[model samples]
Target: MSVRVFVVGIGSGDPGHLTGEAVAALNAVDVFLVADKRAATRDLVTLRAELCAAVITHDRYRFVEVPDPERGPDAERDSTAYAGAVRDWHTERARRHAEAVTREVGDDGTVGLLVWGDPSLYDSTLRVVETIGDLLGAEGVTLEVTVVPGISSVSLLAARHRVALNRVGRPVHITTGRRLVGEYDDALGDVVVMLDGDLACAGLVETHPDLEIFWGAQLGLYDEALVRGPLREVLPEIRRRRDAVRAARGWVMDTYLLRPGTGR
Candidate 1:
């Protein structure tokens, strides 16, 4: 018996953010694999409960903490080591997830994984699935896959800030904070950066201090916070707030967008 998989994105941390179809698919899955950075971040579980809205109980819900492959034993906060370590970690996680699927699904069930945001976005759940699929195929296990889309950090950021993704007729660039730091490029339209470890804006500011940045933290939830202004002025406050919230809550998932000075 082969196992099929469905990966659902839970969207930031809000159960309400889940689309109707996503909720239906989530409830129908035979096994739900939840990947949390730490078991402490119960946001996914909580979101499930909230979205279900009727005291739903999943006999097959399995919470798996993948230990964020991005941070390893020497995982420094947002360091290069952290990045590489995560790649290695995800490889391991996919292997373990494959094992879990084999056991629980018994080679004939649908295993579902709830991703934090849109799977097509920065979320690595898809990559994990790919790795696991390859391993399973090598081991002579067949598999099929499906991905349920959910709101992304960028969409949530735009909603929280009450701003449109792009101006009237402008194109938008969506990239990571690291990329922004590495390449000091600007857009004539709008620029949105995600997966930023609090470095993109700062890096942009040293050279283009006047660039306007709209930052949002924990978007779509009650603890949500947002800041907007010139990068130089808002960068420090964003860092402070980002740090303070992470320390206070033990985890954070944020997304921000930087718009070049088009005087709009």
Candidate 2:
């Protein structure tokens, strides 16, 4: 019996965002493995369940929640320490994933891991899945990995803004808030930042006086919010709106496009 793991990107929130391929993958899965983070993020876990219920026509599938291991806070805030914490968390995650796959779906069944955005974009499921394969392998269980891409928050952000990500002849760069904190480079034609609830662009307000930002939160969902304009003028508004969203919903997923404001 072999296990085939499908890392399916379920998009930001909407079930309608599911591509035909993602739907097929959903139907193929015998069990859908989800990370049970905590009470604060329970809404996100429920959202994934609703998405699957809406799209998957079959009732043969089951969902198994894997309790995510708690990570210690890095008071040092050093990049090295932060990465080390993440690595240790992933190691435990791999062990739990291997157990869940075998216990619920068995070695002969297929399972799916629902990723919020495109697996390649900031999500760590693929990396953890790679380790899961190794763990399963050592157990004499054959494993196969498959990734189905879906609509990313960046795509949803562009659609909401009704704007393209890059200027003519300009390239687009995608990065995280942590990286954007200090790695805000000038060479990229356009910049898209994700996974940052805190305004990583706060510092750029003065650094790039001509900087412009297009930001959105809870994208693709009914309560979605959007803000744009000069970095200086919109920074406060973004902070207000972002904080409101978190206060109201207890969580927020946001993405933004930053440009040098050379034109338009």
Candidate 3:
């Protein structure tokens, strides 16, 4: 009677991005674990619920809303502090997840956590599940995890821009906004930056005035916006539009690709 948890990727907030495997996983689960963090993310929470309703046909499945942990201010500061804070947050979230599973789910029931992007990507749901298993193991609750991969924002970004992620014989470098600031190099080939809250693309444009940028916010959503051109030329518009969008929506999820040439 082991507990089985499926970490399912819902694909950048678009139901159209759902794969066959993701649909099957969604229907197979008896419980869906949803994390309601901030008011800014209410749209995402709604989208997850909408997806569940659209796919799951039976009334046997239920949803469990979990209050997300408070991440310290250190997460927005330095790298070391951010890592430590995230680890602490994940630990608390794992405890909450285990509690929810133990209380709401049957011994052999299948539970699911819908992640925004692929679990193997920048998402931390898989890591939290690992911690959940560790915390419950000593209490005689055995856990088994199954990963169902779905579309990633990187794939959506490239598809929306209609460009290849890499040039011939070159590799693509995927990094976060924090690391992109100091680690960007011309030798890294095409750079795809994600989870950037600080407009790191604008900073990159300042440093490398000739670099080309393909930037998109709220990818695959109804109000999705894209800006592309020489970074210096498009930086102002991107900043202005991004600010306006964030103000309107209360939050933003954006990613970009920094190419070396003019993209010609």
TM-score against truth, every candidate: 0.84, 0.95, 0.96
Please report, in order, the local distance difference test score of every candidate based on alpha carbons: 0.73, 0.87, 0.87
Q: lDDT for model 3, on a 0 to 1 scale?
A: 0.87
Candidate 2 displacement at residue 24 in angstroms? 0.9
Q: List the candidate 2 regions with Cα displacement exceeding 4 Å.
A: 74-76
lDDT of 1 by residue, 17-126 (tens): 77877877776777666555566566556675555453235665544443343344542336676677778888988887877766667657777777667899877778
Q: What tens-digit string does per-residue lDDT give for candidate 2 at 86-142? A: 999999998998899878876579989999878988888988998988888887888
**Candidate rank order under TM-score:** 3, 2, 1
Worst 10 residues of 3 by lDDT: 72-81
Candidate 3: residue pairs that collide: none
Off by over 4 Å in 3: 74-76
Please report the candidate that would top TM-score against the real structure: 3
lDDT of 1 at 18: 78
